[model samples]
Structure formats: structure tokens, C-alpha cells
Target: MNVSLLLILLLVGAIVTYLAGDKLASKVALFFGLASLGCTIVLLNHYNLGENISFITRWITQPNVSFALKADGLSLAMVLLTTALTPIIIFSSFGNEYKNSKAFYALILFMSFAMTGTFLASDGLLYYIFWELALIPIYFIALIWGNGDAEDRKKAVVKFFIYTLAGSLFMLVAFVYLYLKAGSFLIEDLYKLNLSSSEQLWIFLAFFLAYAIKIPLIPFHTWQANVYQKAPTVGTMLLSGIMLKMGLYSVIRWQLPLAPLAAKEYLPVLIGIGIAGVIYGSIVALRQKDLKKLLAYSSLAHVGLISAGTYTLTLDGLRGSVLQMIAHGFVVVGLFFVAEIIFRRYETRTIAEMGGIRAQTPKFTSLFLLLVLASVALPTTFNFVGEFTVLYSLSQINVWFAVLGGTTIILGAYYMLKMFQYTMLGETNKRIFADVTANEGITLVLIVAVLFFFGLYPKPIIDLITPSLEEILTQINRIN
Candidate 1:
């Protein structure tokens, strides 16, 4: 079968999984996820470094739009990440018995389809459609399955939905404006259209609001902590691990190249906000009692640095941001999964409530320790490689920015260590707790292996993204 056909089949399988009932839903979802991974490997095998794979059939003639999908190195990388993680996420949720398991699995599979579409979409309208489509399942997943005060969860979901949709409306306006001026909604065409500085500024702001809300950069991020804390483990995993990347990815794909001059001129202000988010997020995390909430704030800090690195518009900065996105996805998902394990054992997410767990669950403690270290970006972890490159790139733009941004490492270490010391070290809490289950252990171990494997040898990911980053940089450089 053609590769594109396989992609369509994966979506079809998701629907079928939904109808298959509880016993078979997980099995079907797992099969589709593995098949998607298989397709990704096939794509990797056929991938050409210098060329993109395009599959398009005209959808509308008047607007000059087509049902277009294409994969470059960057898109392919994201696709692989999506495929690789979806199965793990699906499997990770097996421990929780949901009232509607079939619907739950269906939503997960559907989310995978939407995310894959987001990465492959070449048309601006199509990208936005998929972008919005991706949020629906997650919203439902969090709304129906989330923990915390029932009323609070509902409020968090609504706030998240409203905040994201509001930001995206601005992006839609930006897209429509580009379509009006450029006479097409194709991303490549938008890239080629030359706009006056005034037009660029307005367009840039519109796009910035959309992506910033998704990245949830400070002030705009008011909704994220509540949402993450209320969300189910699987919901949090999808949100942090992949959904957040959509915003960061757009910053590179749309904002930077579309308005190069605006990006260059506003880079400093952007970097300053990124620095503030880093400090603010870390400080906030330091005070968070709920482990999930702490990780949520920590995620904000990490992505802030990524946003700053992206604005630098240097080759290393771009490369680092992309790499960091991948690394953070894996690390954060793993961290949340570990949190889920603790919650399962102790029936609580409070850090103070968890004590002396290391004695009872040595294996769980060991894996948790490694994940915490990865979160803090210890050497030979993927986070270290990404942070080092991002900071190096930032230094070229401004030493102070680098200095401010580098505090993430210090702050990261402080929070992660504090959590670790409280949870795993010292006296054993006399309360009864189960050791890590086989399934939980396998999931975490797999994630940690990937983190270390990529950390020690980031050359492969860097090599994959470099050509595409260079292509994007070339376009930006042409403006000046």
C-alpha cells in the first residue's frame, strides 16, 4: 500500500477501534499505533535529505487550495515522534479502568490522527483546521476523565478551551489576511509574498498570539497550570508531550519566515519575556504542593527558554529549540508517567504526602531518580544537549539573555531535587504503598532509554533537522 494510504488507514482504524468495545478497543488502538510507527519507519527509509514528499489532490479551485500534505525533515521528525509516543501513551493508560474504555481509546487514536495532520499540512487553512481539530479530543479527555475538584476541573477545561480558541482566532485572521494579500493559502506562497513592514507587524502579532497561547508563554499561561493539574495522566502526557509542540513548531514554521524583519526587530522583547517566564515558572513550581502542578510549571519554564531560543533565529538556536522540543516531550511525558505511578501507589499527588518510597520500591525509585536527572538536564541526557545548544545560540545574540535563561538549569535542579529528596530519600512513611507495576516500569524504562540514547548521540536528530533549518534560515536571510 502507498504510504499516504496507510496514513488514511490509521485514521480509519481509530474509528473502528471506537466501535470495537472495551475488550478490543485497547488492542485495536495498539495495533493502529504500531502500524503508524511502522509507516514512520518506512518513511524514514524512503526519506531523502534534500527533498520533500508531497501528496495533494485539489480540494477547492476558487481559493487555490488543495488537500495538500507534505513531509520535509522537520515534519517527518515530528511524525515519528508522534507515532512513537502514541502507543506508549495508550499502553500507559491501561492501568486506569475507565467507564467508557472504547471511547477513551478512540479519543487517543483520533488525537494521534489530528496531530499527524498538523505536522504534515502544507496549506495554511488545512494546518489551522487540523490545529483546531486536535484540541477537541483533548478537551473532552480532560473534561470527562480529569481529577481534582469536579467544579474546578470543569472550570479549568473551559478556561483552557476559551484561551486556546481565542488565540487561534487571531491566527485565523492572520491567515485570511495573508490569503487576501498573497492570493493563496499555501505556506510556500505566503513565504514568497513580500509585505510592507506595517503589514508584517500586524500579521506577526496575530500569529504570535496564536502560538504564544499554545506555548502558553507567561501571563497568557494562566490557564495551563490548572488544566494540567486537573487533567488525567494520559491527558497531561498528550498535552505536555506533543500538543505544546504545535505552538513552538508554528513559531518556527509560520512566524519566523513569514515576518522575518518583524521577528528580528522584536527578538529582544520576545527573549525578555522568555527569560521572565523561566524565572517566574521556576519560582512558581518551587511552591507547588501537587507533583503534577509542579511539573506543569516546570514545563512552562522549559518551553519559555525554547521560545527564546527560537526568537534568536540563529542556526544553533533553531536547531536547539527543535531538539529541546523533542527532548522535553519525552522527558515531561516520562516525568508525568512517574507521577502517575506514585499516584497509583499512594492515591495522592501531594509531594509532602509522599515519603520514604525508595525503601519499598527500589526499582521505581531508581527510574524516578533517572527521570528527575533527565528533567534537570544532567550530562549525557538529551535535555543537556538541547539546553547547551540553546544557551550557546542565545549567547551569540546577548550574553545577559543567556545568563538569565541559564537560571532554568539552577532552578530546574532545585525543584527536581527537592521533589526527589522529599519523595524518595530519608525515612519510610509508614503508610502502605505498592511497588511499581510491571507495565509502569516498562513504560518509564523505555522512555528513559530513549532519553539517554538520544542524549549521548544527538547527531542523528541534529543531522535530520539541519538541512530544513538551513532552508528556513536561507529564506529569512534573503529578506535582509
Candidate 2:
């Protein structure tokens, strides 16, 4: 079947499942998830030999908008990630006996559709529409299914919603300005326009605010930890695992090449913020007692490295950023899932409340240990590969920057191990805790296998992304 047809079918299936009610809702959603995965695999197979797929239909003519979707190596990779993980996330939700099962399953599938659209959108307006569209399901997901004080979750969700919407309005204005100047909303048209340096700077700042808020770098990151802490584990997984990459991806696709000189001029300041976020996030994470909050801060630190790498504008830096994004997505999701398991058993997220978990749950201990090692960038884990590449790229920019940035590894190990020792090792408290179930074990072991596989063989991913990265760099160089 055609890819677009498959996408439409997935949405339709979701709607149908949502109406099907509790008894069959989850099963129907699972079927759609598996079907989407199958379609994604077929799309990947076809694209492996170098093919491009695009579908466009006119939506508006006054400002010249179209519902345009295009898939290249990058888009396909993101689609695969979205589709592959959606099933696992759906499966993960099996453990929760939600009140409105149909609505819960429906939201998961709808989120899949929005994410797919975000990656495949080729028109600037269409991209923005999908970008904002992706946030709605998540907002409801967090508000309805989240843990913690109901009022706290409500407040956090509102803050997250407002911050993202406010930033995106800036992006909308920037896109409209580009549309006025370039006379087209198509990405390629915007890419071809030659804006004056002054204009580019303003436009770049507008785009930067939009993406930055989503990435939630530094001062803009206040909403993230609280949201992650309050949101359901599945919601947190979707936000951190796939949603955050949207911002980083846009930086590469829209910011750098579109406003090359501004990017170059602003590179140092951006890198400074990135480095600061890395240290600040790590330090703050050191003090977090809640596992989810700690993971959120660690995520900030990791993405800070990614942001810094992107500003370097070197091949190694860009490549590493992309690789790091994929690595971080997997590792963070796994870490949060482990957190969920612990919370389920202990009925608390505070690390101090738990002790000697490994003694009671050897399997959980083994998985948690692997996740910590990956978090700390141990050799032969995907995180190691990404961190090594990023630091290598940073060293080329400045040895000192690399040295400072490299401290994250030590700091990361310190906090992660400290948390582990406090929770997983040491003397048993004589409090009985359930071991990891077969389902949780399956999810974690699968992630670990993928982590190891990618670490050992990153060449394929590098090869797939190289052509696109080189094309992007060439564009930036031309404008520079």
C-alpha cells in the first residue's frame, strides 16, 4: 500500500478503536500499531536503495499553503523511531488499568500520527501545524493520566503548553516573514531565498526562540522537570524520547542553512549556553531525590551537548548531534521505564526511601545497572559512541571546550552511581519488593540489545545520515 494511505489508515484505525470501547480498544490499537510498523518497514526497504516519496495537495491559495509531505533519509529514520516505539509504549500501557481505556489508546495512536506528520511535512506552514498539533494529545495525556498532586500536574501541563505555544508564535511570525519575502512556503523555496544579514538575524532569533523553548535550554527549561515529574511514565517517554528531537532536527533543517551568517556570528554564545546547561543540569541532577526529575535534568545535560555540537558546524559535530539524538532517545526512554518499574514496586519516587533492591530483584538490578552504564557512557553502549563523537567534534573547535564538556561523563557517572548505590545496592531494608515482571523485562532487554547493536555497528546509521548532513553543510557553507 502507498505510505500516505497507510498513514491515513492508521488514523482511521485509531478513531475506530477509540469508538470500540474498553473490551477491544487496546487490541485494536495494537493492531494499528503493528500495521503502521509493517508499513514503515516497507517504506524503509524501498528507500534503502535511494528513493524519495512526496504527497502534496493544495490547502490554501491566498498565502500559498499546501498539505505537503516528503520523506528522505532523515524523515524515514524518525518515522521508524516513532512507529517502532509506539507499539512498545502501547504494550507498556498494558500494566495500567486506566479508567478510560479507549481514550487512552486513542491518544497514543493520535500522537503517532502527529509525530509522523511533523517529520514528513515539507511546507513550512504544514510543518508548523503538525508541530503544534503534536503537543495537544500529550497535554491531555499528561493532564488525565499523570501521577502526583492533581493540581501540580495541571499547573505543570499549563506551563508547558503556554511556553511552547508562545515560542511557536514567534516561529509562525518568522515563517510568515519568510513567506512574504520568498513568495512560497515550500522548504526548498525558503532555502533558495537570499535574505539580507539583518533580516536573517531577526528571522533566526524568532526561529531560535521557538526551537529553544521546545529543546528547553537553560533558563527556558523550568517547565520540563516539573512536567516530567508529574506526567505519566508513557507521557514522559513520548516527550523525552521523540518529541525533544523535533527541536534539534529543526535547528539543522531550518536555522543553520537558512541563516548561515547569523548562526556563525551567534555560535559562541549558543555554545556557551550549551556548556552552561550541561554543567548546571548535571549539578542540579546531583541533588534530585526523585528519579524522574533526575532523568529530566540528565536529559537537559545531554541535549546541551547536542546543541553545542550543532553550533560547531563541523561534519563530526553535526553527525555526532544526530547520532546522540538517537542514542539519547533510546537511553532516556529506557531510564524512565526503569523509574516506572521502581515506582510501581516501592510506591514512591524518592531514592532515599528504597534500599538493597538488587538483593530482592536481581533481574531489575541487572537492567538498572546496564541503563546506568549507558547513561554514564560506558564503552560499547550507544551513549559512549555518541559522547565520544561529540567530544571529538568539540575538541576540534577548542580543546578547552571539549575538556569542560567532557566533565559531564564524570558527573554523570557520579550521580547515576550514587543513585544506584542508594537504591539498588547496600543493606536490604527488609521491605518486600516485587521483581520485574516478564513484560518489563522484555521491554528493557530489547532496548539493551538495540543499544549494544548500535554501539557495535554505528557505521550504517552514519552512512545513512552522511549524505543529508553533507548536503546541509554545503548549503550553510554556500551562504556563509
Q: Who wins the lDDT comparison? A: 1
Over 4 Å off, model 2: none
Worst 10-residue stretch by lDDT in candidate 1? Answer: 1-10
Note each model's CA RMSD in angstroms: 1.3, 1.3
- Those runs of model 1 whose alpha carbons end farther than 4 Å from true positions after fitting are 1-3, 49-52
Clashes of each: 0, 0
- What is the C-alpha lDDT profile of model 2 across 169-219, one tens digit per residue? 999999999999988899888989888899989989999999888987888
Tens-place lDDT per residue, model 1, 123-207, is 9999999899999999999999999788999999999999999999999999999999888888888999888888889999999
TM-score of each: 0.98, 0.97
With candidate 1 superimposed using the best TM-score fit, by how many Å does residue 423's alpha carbon deviate from the native?
1.0
